[model samples]
Target: PAASEGLPRPIAGIGRPVTAQEIAGWDVDVRGDGEGLPPGRGSVKEGEELFVQQCASCHGDFGEGLERWPALIGGRGSLNTDQPRRTVGSFWPYAPPVFDYIRRAMPYATPMSLSNEQAYALTAYVLHLNELLPEDAELDAEKLKSIRMPNRDGFVPEARPDTPDEACMSSCRQGRPVAVTMDSRRFVQPGSGSGFSEPQ
Candidate 1:
């Protein structure tokens, strides 16, 4: 009867259910309160070594970031600057995310290859570079939550609305109607049309 029913109406679900071990490997999200962090220990000293070899290139020797690259340290009193450098020390709200992020994605060319202990050590080292943690400090899942960021209070909830409901189709500015002063096409190659030259 099942064979006559056209392969039993085809299976509703195709693949086997994911096992707990598989879930554990992929669902390693570290929460803000340090929940879901794996059990591992690392010291700042250990971090410095790994960072120099694995992280110093893009992030700079002290997490200062290469030219035009993302910096991980400094910028402590720069949130209000004209051009602020939003490094981990300056903008990140928590430390656990740093550890989780580094473990998940880091070293640019390589990702998700650091051992848990290495990740913890790198986290501590980055904090140390930021002047948040002591050079000799150790960080673990339990200790990571206690760390605070310089700009932790830099951001706050804005209860009030930031935009108006009115739809502005035109004339949104207070100044006199601006005139077209310059044409960008003049600066382009073959400014009259497409950049390609016409055939002879």
Candidate 2:
């Protein structure tokens, strides 16, 4: 006899299958290759206005970022430096995701509040701030996908060797393990209650 022969049947009307329309509403993600971008257009000028109104509080007027907030512009050649500034221009490899992120989560206090046009405009404005787009540039799905970020070729494929299929029960290390200590005092601020005083 089948397993279901002795088991209780599934209860009917427990819940309905998810509808296509509901799934469509939640399927708003845009891919790096510009797939799933909604039909909308926005200019850098319009983006600037929207940025000042909605994003300046956290990202700053020029995408310079506020205190404790992230900076969006500059950092063109600092990726290899000791203090790398990972901004939209210096780090991001694609553009469509910019619009995706803004449309899905932004304005800090409010998420998913911007319309498609507004999201495009904001993406254009941020690109302009990073010197990736001209002042009069307008962006739509196609245009956004066509844009090649500065760091588009920065990333490389994973080259590290994969682990063996069989796990090692013991004797994994070939050398003695070295213990490294990190001084947290340098990271603590003078008045942050860490009790570590900075040298004058």
Candidate 3:
């Protein structure tokens, strides 16, 4: 059969569609608790090398963040103050999310290009730099999830309406409502009286 005869015509309004494989290639995302982490591992030494070559330009050689690129370490205990400076070693709740974010989008321009092992190494290196992990440690998906953050316990659980017996109106007071007043000057009067000329 001829090619045109064998294949159906494209949809009228549809353009070229993307394949599932293509989408999946760009959809790499690791969740907390290592849900979507790829099978790979990285060591602190490997991460330091990659960081110097790929990250040191924007972020300082020591992960201090060049100019305003954002520091990858330090800022511990800063979140307790009114004006907090958050960093990987400080306010982040989970360590796995950091690896996931880096793997998905990093190196600024070339995002989602690093291998799973490279990502793990970078995560380990950054954690070590921040003093969150030991220097000789290796980071894989499993251990990444297990790494607890200092600020993890600082955040409080979201407060929601409790059961009728436990609920207290005084403890959870809803704000008072405001009344709206219409101003005549805001609208324009129509010359021909056609709905006030839509208020010029």
Clashes of each: 0, 0, 2
lDDT of 2 by residue, 60-107 (tens): 999999997999998889999998999899999999999998899897
Q: Give the Cα lDDT of each candidate.
A: 0.86, 0.91, 0.83
lDDT of 3 at 98: 88
Q: What is the C-alpha lDDT profile of model 3 across 1-200, one tens digit per residue? A: 67578688677977767898897786687666667777889999999999999999998988899898998877777776787889888888888888988887888899888988899999999999988878899988778888998887777878877655665657354665655597555675535544644656
Judged by whole-model lDDT over C-alpha atoms, candidate 2 comes out at 0.91
Question: What are the clashing pairs of model 2?
Answer: none
Pick the winner on TM-score between candidates 1 and 3: 1
Residue pairs with backbone atoms closer than 3 Å in model 1 (clashes): none
Query: What tens-digit string does per-residue lDDT give for candidate 1 at 1-200?
Result: 65587555557679789999999989978987788889999999999999999988888888888987788877777778797878888899888999989998987779989999999999999989988889899999888989877777778887688777898777776667878898776777544555447674
For model 1, the stretches where C-alpha displacement exceeds 4 angstroms are 1-15, 158-161, 167-175, 179-200
Model 2 is weakest, by summed lDDT over 10 consecutive residues, at 189-198
- Poorest 10 consecutive residues of model 3 by lDDT? 188-197
Global Cα RMSD, each model: 8.2, 7.0, 12.7
Shift in Å, residue 130, candidate 1: 0.8
